[model samples]
Target: MNRKQPIFYLCSDALGDTAEMVVKATMQQFAVDEVNIKRYHYIQTEEEIYALILDAQENGGIVAYTLVEPNLREVMKRSAIEHDVQAIDIIGPLMQAYIDTFNDSPKEMPGLQYELDAKYYNRIEAIDFAVKYDDGKNIGGLLAADIVLVGVSRTSKTPLSIYLAHKGIKVANLPLIPGIAPPSEIFTLQNTLIVGLTMDPNHLLKVRTERLKVIGLPNTTSYTEYEPVKSELNYGNMIMKQLMCPVINVSNKSIEEAAVEILGLMNKK
Candidate 1:
């Protein structure tokens, strides 16, 4: 068996959860099979902090520490020395890079910049909400989405959503169910850039067939039959047409490629 590479995350109290989500998502994107991650809370005592470091060192993997408090910086430095593994302190490098790149020309913000921050934050929250719940009823959550995807089941919506999120673009993906009426607002969201994803019928059937078997569902040929798959694609296109959405055939594309196409459309819009 290939040895699992451990990644220790010693994060400040404020940055842990976000960091964990980002790192785990990145690992999945890289298709890493063996990874172990651990998070540490902000520490007060030297002994307690040192014990955490000791445990990470014994785990014999890379350590990534995010320290916001200057007081704990020395302890972290010492731990890195003792661990003899690849260590990265997140903020230090990021700040250094920012200073090196943008130190010369500083731009002043407008008086309303602070107010606009709340607007942008709300937009991001709405995008996340829509990505999680893409049903037509929750189209309100996708109001802030720059790109919205509509497709049949198992058409790579979720992975594409994550991919777009990593690029700082809010993506919302909704599935099309044939014979079932879609939510109302999806037909009226003219401000949103919508993309419909379609796949080859034979390929779609094969994938759904295997998926159903894996989940111990009845291997009904409904999803895999040629006419049913064709109807699903047609229904998805009809939904897009009613919404004035652009359609993309993603059957031959990777998730990253699909995300890139979606982003390009957003930029064009």
Candidate 2:
């Protein structure tokens, strides 16, 4: 028998996006109801809450909503019971207690203002390009980069790029396609430090095959055969050798370790 999966519909304009992303991240950690969780946002009024309740009822799962207003909270609680769904109002109790217990301490207001400014003062932008094509992207402006990474395709380039980027590195990755030759501009960028990433031939072939299938491409020998991978790696290594670039084998390295290694490389340079 299938277990009763608990689904929540969170509702808060201020906390909506961050809360939804948090729940989504948490869902991945759970084996139960991992795929069943969803979030609803921008719920400020009673009608909006009621609409979400109706939606959750048809699905027959828990309906967790949040509200800032006291009157709306009461309305939602009644609606939740009427819909026969488990409901959780995330804000009511916390707000009541906070109001009752806290004094008007305007002295801490400056610190709070400072904290808010510090938290979001330097949010990073999305990496518009995928990591598989990083070898082709230019990092000439990456002197602001906390760490830079270079590697051939499917060698965990995208994840590492995102990871280092999250750590405040304006990480620019260039994907190296063996025998295709890196563009001439890459050779001229002496200001930016580079690290070469390589992986085992067989493992790369397997990963490439899976990626090709997902993109509806043919898993042909030309794209992921052992010889082609080995040749590519050889060419990449030769290019790095000629350039006197430091190389790292990433087949066994975790994302954190790769980022750390890159940081060390940058520090040494």
Candidate 3:
């Protein structure tokens, strides 16, 4: 006989995001397909919890819940046991552990994790700022940015800027070309961290060559040539020296690794 599709019933006092995440992650560990995830959010009363447990039991679904209220959780537990349904508490054990270890009580509020507060708003604004000022589109963003990234092509400037921006740091990145002078505003920035990104010339050449192939362009262009790549690196190094900012060689660093280093430098400054 063919097996029935696996079903997960997610219950939460707020948006069912927490329970849904846990269910999805657990699903990844199994080779199951056609899995159904049903989210029941804003659960309040004991009747609602029992209803959800009954639904799960009828559908042969497992329940994963992040209910913050102790009474609601008790109802869910009891109903699941009475109805022979499997129920997993996503946050209760962790909350209990925190209470035991730290001798503290939780606020037990729902949707606190998804609060649209100042930090959330700031992160959104930073993301917009990163997009608007990306690739030196507007040099004026230099003065307003929390971090300014200057680098030659394929130096991970754009990715690093976006990563930092997601952490609520407004970042502006500018490409350093061989013959082009950077914006004058970059020279006069106050209270902004300027980071220079560089990569090994040979590695950059390989990356550029692959980029050309991916874009159906010829590798004969100066972009993929060793001499021009070396010149661009030399010019970038010179500009970094003139700016007197810290330089990061992104030759073997991932975006996460580079972002951590940049954050450390930011803390030091």
Q: Encode model 1's per-residue lDDT on 1-269: one tens digit a residue.
A: 12656565555534355456556766787767766777776555567557766776677655566555555656777766876645667555665587699885323221222354756676566557555665544665556566777888988877777676655566777778987877776667767787888888877887788889999999766777789788888887888788777788887789978877877887787
Worst 10 residues of 1 by lDDT: 105-114
Indicate the worst ten consecutive residues by lDDT in candidate 3.
Answer: 1-10
For all candidates, the clash counts are 0, 5, 0
Model 2 Cα shift for residue 143 (angstroms): 6.8
lDDT per model vs. reference: 0.69, 0.66, 0.91
Top TM-score hit = 3
Candidate 2 per-residue lDDT, tens place, 45-91, comes to 77887887897788776655555556666887899899886777654
Report clash pairs, candidate 1.
none
262 Cα displacement, candidate 2 (Å): 5.6
TM agreement with the true structure for every prediction = 0.66, 0.59, 0.73
Evaluate model 2: give its lDDT.
Answer: 0.66
Candidate 2 regions with alpha-carbon error over 4 angstroms: 1-6, 29-34, 37-39, 50-60, 64-134, 137-147, 158-168, 180-193, 237-269
